[model samples]
Target: MTTKKLTWVSMLLAMCVLGANFKLLGSIALDSFPAFLGAMILGPVYGAFLGIAGHFVSALLAGFPQTLPIHIIIGFLMGICMFIFGLVRKKAMGDGIMVKAVSWLIAYIVSVPLNLLILYPVLHEVVFVLFVPLTIATLANLLISELVYAVLPSKIKNFGQSKVV
Candidate 1:
């Protein structure tokens, strides 16, 4: 398949996953699922769409505060971070644990400030004691998500392969 077709397919799959996540879990956090995996598997742009669209829909349904701006920023940053992972993966082009680990690390690092600055304030919680736990949770979620994606069957992996020809 061509890269463009692959991207569109990935985006569609990401959106479906995002919707299922929100519907089943009710939040955009680890409770539902991590957006980072989608970002990592699909390219940054598709990943960003997944993150932003997922959060926006979840917020509307769950009554989350400052939905648009916060999610937009978070999605964009997370996408950029995941894009880095995608680039690295493209270079390595390997489905190994090391790649997954690095991708998780990148997602966690990017999510920390985004959550602390953009999300916490909206939730009306101080970033004092909550910061550490939140960071840990975010990291954990990213790791689990990456692991899930990395170990997916070949059919699923094929879903993410770029067809930009």
Candidate 2:
């Protein structure tokens, strides 16, 4: 990666680390914003890296909860789906509200079922309870990503576009 991209990756990781601390709207972890932003700006691979690492780091700092695997898996899935949707959004839609909405919507759609499979086996809680929180958190992440995109400068926004995503 170039110096610029490396710098962004570092910055986003810090954002993810800090954001992970402030959860709101029930399960809506703030960490998702940094991860999604990283993906949207730097591309999917970096997003995934931030997600996986951020989730773990947050958990570690927060006392290493028992539900470690679930969080990690969710993070991984979030990155993957975001990358895929981003590609489709960029190619077919060419950056618009619908693209953001659908990309996020699809990320949630793809993650829920897959996550359910993992959640059931690991957490062993009532499906609805876990499902609701996850949904809220994911949705929050999506909205934040869109907001970040809107607020960012064009120069910074377009900085590393050719490198990834």
Candidate 3:
């Protein structure tokens, strides 16, 4: 990575660490914005890195209420989620308000099955209880990413983005 990309990664990681303070449930916090933003601006790989690290930080802060192994699994799942999210957003990129709206809608909708797929067997019915809050967290995270990405300078958005999506 270039110095610029490294710097931005550091900044996002810092933001993710700070975001751990806003806990929603157990280790689940509103800390995913940085990861989502990383996905948008950096790429899917960075998104996975931030997502796993971000969740780990939140889990750490919460004393690993769900146990370290489970949290580790969750962190990996978060990584997968970020990867898919980045891929979808990459394909969805374009001009037009309708396209933008559709992209946002798809980003939000994409999380449902991913959350349920792995979580259902582990969480069973308990996944239902978290669906709302996790969905809300995902919405908040994507909104923050969209808002930030919208305001960023073109140079910054395009920086270190070559061969990345």
Best by lDDT: 3
Off by over 4 Å in 1: 1-28, 31-34, 66-68, 114-125, 129-133, 162-165
Mind giving the per-residue lDDT tens digits that candidate 1 earns over 9-42? 5665454445534332233444323345555555
**Cα lDDT, model 2, residue 82:** 57
For candidate 3, write residues 1-165 as lDDT tens digits.
Answer: 777788888999999998888988887687889988887778788988999999999999999886788788778888877877666666665635665576556556655556566767877887787788778777877788778888999877776356533
- In model 2, the worst 10-residue window by lDDT is 23-32
Cα-based lDDT for every prediction:
0.56, 0.70, 0.78
What TM-score do all the candidates reach, one by one? 0.62, 0.82, 0.85
In model 2, state the lDDT of residue 139. 79
Please estimate how well model 1 matches the true structure, expressed as its whole-model Cα lDDT.
Answer: 0.56
- In each prediction, how many residue pairs overlap at the backbone (N, C-alpha, C within less than 3 A)? 7, 1, 0
User: Least accurate stretch of 10 residues (summed lDDT) in model 1?
Assistant: 23-32
Cα lDDT for residue 71, candidate 2: 61
TM-score: which candidate is best? 3
Tens digit of per-residue lDDT, candidate 2, span 69-115: 66677667666765775565555536776776677777788656666
Candidate 3 off by > 4 Å = 93-110, 162-165
